[model samples]
Target: MDAPVSTSPRPWSPPPDASDVVKSIHAMLHPRNIVVVGATDKPGNYAERIWNNLIKYGYEGGLFPVNAKRESVWGVPCYKDFASLPEPPDHVLVLVPARLAVQVIRDAAASGARSATIVTSGFSELQDEESQRLAAELQQAVRETGLAVTGPNCLGNLSAGEKLFTNIDDRAVTMVQGPVAIAGQSGAIVMAIRQTLEDRGVGIGYMVTTGNEAGLETTDLMNYFVVDPSIRVIVVYLEGVRNTKAFRDACKAARAAGKPVIALKLGASEGGRAAAMAHTGALAGSIETFDAIATREGVIRVQNLDQLIETTECFVHAVTPKGNRLAAVTLSGGKRGLLIDAFDAVGLNFAPPSPGISAELGAMLGPGSIVGNPLDAGFAAVVDPTVYMRAIKLMIDDPDTDIVIIDAELPKAPHELRERNLRRVNDMAGEASKPVIYVSAMSIGFTDYTKELRQTLPHVTVLQGLDRAVTAIKSLIDYAALPKQVPDVASSSKPSARATLEKILKQAEGAALDEVDSKKLLKAYGIPISKEAIAQSAIEAIKIAKSIGFPVVAKVVSPDILHKSDIGGVMLNLTTPAAVGKAFADITARVKKLKGKPKLEGILIAKQVNADLELVIGASLDAEMGPVVLFGSGGLDIELMKDVALAGAPLNEADARALIGRTKAGVKIKGYRGKPALHEASAVKALVGLSNLISDAGQRIASIDINPFLINPKTGVAVDALIVLNNEAARQSFDKSTKGKSTKKGGGH
Candidate 1:
């Protein structure tokens, strides 16, 4: 069978010079020489901290501190300016005030420096005219000189591979180079994440804090890290994204390279969004829209700091699970119960052991053993110690298990029995085909002995805290299940259909289309709308109702009245001409009695559909993510219920189905209780058609709301719809196409 054609908009792409930007970032991170501007001996100054950090980390690069008033900084000879330097610096660190930061960047660029990190804090984040102006000038300087600058209000960055530490953060004094790379808009967040990962023995390859993002944004740093061979996993701490296209490209690049990009996105709450705006001068757009984009790009999103650290640990040390099936073993019954609760909260279930494996475990642990998943190995394992090793090995070898987890604790003091047991388990883990994780019942502080044990047993992933461990395991499984390749969106809209839709839109007289006109647009896109027609008079309405069917619905057709039912302008179950005529008269009278006297276009007579389920499908242009589609329960209580799921559109049947499955309405439609399943395929078709309509029209249509799309056992049909036009686009398109023609007041055929 041939695949259905997609009419969704093409995926957003970064600018053509994205590769060039990445190359410049590489040069900046690996600079052979760095100059720190505004260097001084003033106690507790930013320049002093950066100087001390660079020297402390043993930076091999030629570091020259420039301060006109100082002869030397941190016991290193200081240059007066960029031009007085003996050699051209590849990167410059600007620690001067906001007013002088732009000139320093320009000077560095003019002197052959490829990149600069502006540590100055006064920028748009201050929310003042002068600061905003300074930010603009800084941006202009970067553009004119083609210098890849990092920030105007940031704490700077560090490169562990080069032993380059330019940041003012005191917590990250030790340089530990490993497989993880960190990027964030908040310097404090970047440093905190670095500390957490480092404490867990996971070394960071690079950490870049892009505050204000005057020139170099977080996306640029992400793109650079995706290509760095030393970085195996990328962690991002985002308040908001500056460039949507570039961010998507960077995430996709990481996914294509077989690297996991874990993001700790903030700004889900109202206060958090406001704080993000104040902190970085970046708009923290809708979290739903951000989540939709993240899901499509295969980025793993974490909620808190603990989840972020633990999930990163999973990716760094553990192999990807082949399936969702998990096998957990614990010695203590209480710990087993905690593990079960944590797993259940994350929708994870332990795989039931096979009969043979169960029998073997029961026999080895004696009759007291509970031989299911989360198997309690009893006190026998405690007495012999080898029981744990044998049981873990059995679970790993079980065909039903994809991943195995065992609860164990690292000894604080040296004990021969504990060390011997751990060593045997670790050796078994080394030979196991599946990933074997050692989890603690609660969050634990790492001891010197714990660190040594982890270092010695490299094959075992020790996850502390049962809740965090489950969250990490869930993330690992979810990431592995994500599609490696992004799907392509190829347009296959029929020319005639698109032309008809445009004509309907161009003819729309008001900002919002009346029911008759909205249905016309939907019908043009091959969506099944109710059999209906507009009637200018009672006699005409009666005639239209008869044509539709015996039982029909009559609604007041007015561009001004969006909610017809609220105004008592809707009449249902009109089974005769007399009923239809009275309904038409009543609807017109109700509209005339309104305070503003809303213009009544006519009466709409639509076939009354009796269905088992009602669903709402919609599409709107998001500020950051272009067009997004929504699906959920419908009817008048839609706002109250708020059971909606959103996804970036134009959607194929599969995407439509997935969107539907996220809502409770989807489950009901599939068949709730004893009720039989409705026509879900028809609903999928309507959603796809609506998505294509909005995507094709772009900004011409602002939003589309199709509520109470009635679905019977056989099929679904849109009974009511409203299309809100982008007022500016509608006016411009209307004027351009209908020049010198008689303008229509209301959309009536």
Candidate 2:
């Protein structure tokens, strides 16, 4: 097949007219005739091998060699060049230097050679001026000729069963003619997996290494094979997907075709995945997002290539283990039973073989051998080898068994004993057409022999990590019995910004958000709070306190000072006007003494709040997900515990309500210790509203602080509040501030 030479600019891309190039090159991979460009008397040239492998593998199709410098290299008469070929061979495999390879491709395209494989590199990797020129010019050539590109820095492709073989070290290309097609960036992984597949006698339809993915990228290959009837399983090994539309569409197409696509995309860690994601924002599709998409789209996303293979092995064998329910029949009852317990811990079901089968089993085994669920045939199988066969047939007869797991352990009498039994049951199960899982306890004891057996029973998957087997079971069950939707209850539309106050302080300039600024943002978002006042002096503070009644708090307002105690900026517990005067005097003197601290705007007094308990609700934007609401045990424990769950912004209010349900404060508020239910629903609703508001503000929110959100059975109010605006502070940062100093926690010296 012709490999494409990149012609894109600094960040290489396929030519403008690359579709036809890709199609034609794709066609050449399965060509009837191949013409070798630069065919010579060289012992191991790429072109020579192309011709030899084509013939060596019994490709009865036509072979044409085009060379400007040699004559009769492979016995078939060689032509001077492509122009001299009998009829412009189907594909021209060009083995030339980087400078000359581009023209050779153009000549091949013009001479009717559908595609050209430029098996030369030094194009973009070198970062040299000429290589860049060559890469761009080559890409232009594709636009000029509509020629498809495989790679300029790639190992090329191989489809062994179709006789499309090339020794490009794409590295260990195996001739497995199965139903899976693999697309990979790492030729080494592709090679390793191909070998593993071939070892299992599995066949492959297409294998491509899209290194750098210049043109005719991974998705093009995916899109093409998705429609191909012969391919039913698609495996992708990726550093990343450059085009989301193409990648998604290809996956959709595969699903539409009932093809199972197993992907091992590595990103989300290390520089490679990050680089892959950052360059294209391909979503490197983080694990959570990827799993969600794959589940929704019917794509099986695996972690590494090994899991990719293991998952594929199950699909290829058509082993659809639907339910977690498992029934094991092993040679050793103890070993299989132990495995069953392990499976249980992993959330796997151990379904007992039905009664009728047990009776039928009674006749097969002597009166002594116990034959029930987890039919302990392992010990009995030793006494009677044929007993294994009887147990298997009876187990399959039971309607209760969805998957029959065979735990064959004890060493046999050795006449190719395990193989014989395996063949018998394998053939039986093949005819039965039911899912059968195998775990060789005997093989587990021996590494070499175990590997050997695995090679033979390639259809049987050897699940990794006992934990992994459970995970696999759970995933499969979930797939079969997945729910349509996860319910979301709208909890609140209030801004959950209280914890964000610190962020605001950092960006604070000379002026701070006044109570009006703080309350405006909160009020606009619908968070309920007390009515209040911002009086400046002792007399004014005393009058406001008397009106709000005896128990109001007073504090000096200032953007300059944070800890009100250090500066005597706050005065609390003002039951009498005389007490208020003395508190007011203390705040005024302290403010006059502090540097870089704002003078007291006034002593504000308002209705003081007394609630059952104080709960802190806040919002913080995560590095990935923008804004998140966190609710947990409040007070000093907040920092110590960090026992908080984060939920995305624009949160469902019901989700907010649910968030409280997840916290310890919820139990207290919901009537623990006979405590009446606070306005719990109202508080949660407020938090949810805050989360949405902050999310909408996005970068505009620098921080917010609504500490000690007082909650009682009947009502909840934020006693203290602060709002940090963005680079440019929001004018309405405190719309949710107290109506007045109906608060405590005042500044004090």
**What TM-score would each prediction reach against the true structure?**
0.89, 0.63
Model 1 superposed RMSD (Cα):
10.1
* Candidate 1 per-residue lDDT over residues 1-749, each given as its tens digit: 11111122212233456588877887778776778899888899998888778777877777788888877767767778878787887789998888988888888888899999888888878768998899899888988988888877778888887778898877754586788999887888788898888878787889888888778877888888877778889998877765667788788888888799999887532211111211010122357767887767878888899989989988988887889898988887888888888899988888789888988988888866568788877687777777877888899889889888988867777888878877877787778767888888778898867766667777778888888888888888888888788775544467887998878877887657888888988887878998889999999988888777879999988887766888998899899999999998888888888986778889989899998887888776654556667788888777678778888778888888999999999999889998999999989988888889878987677678787889988989999887767675334543554468662111000
Report lDDT (Cα) of residue 599, candidate 1.
84
Candidate 2 residue spans exceeding 4 A from truth = 1-28, 38-40, 77-80, 113-118, 124-145, 169-176, 267-289, 358-373, 409-417, 441-749
lDDT of 2 by residue, 1-749 (tens): 32212222221223454455345545645665666667777777666666666655545456677776766776767788767665546655656788887888777777776655555676765667998898888778866877666656555567555566653442334454568888776666776677666554456877776654445667778776765556778887766555544666667667666677777766542211211211111122244334433454556777665556556666676465555567777666577667777777856767656777777888778787666667777666778778888888777667777777676532323348767777666666675545776654332333445545555554454444444444455545554454333333333442345334334444456323555456656766777776668777778877887777878877666654433545666566778889888888887787887765565566556567887877776664322223445565554355565444444455666667767886678778788987677788768766866776666665555445565578887888766665544432232222222124332110000
Model 2 alpha-carbon miss at residue 725, Å: 15
Error of 1 at 417 (Å): 2.9
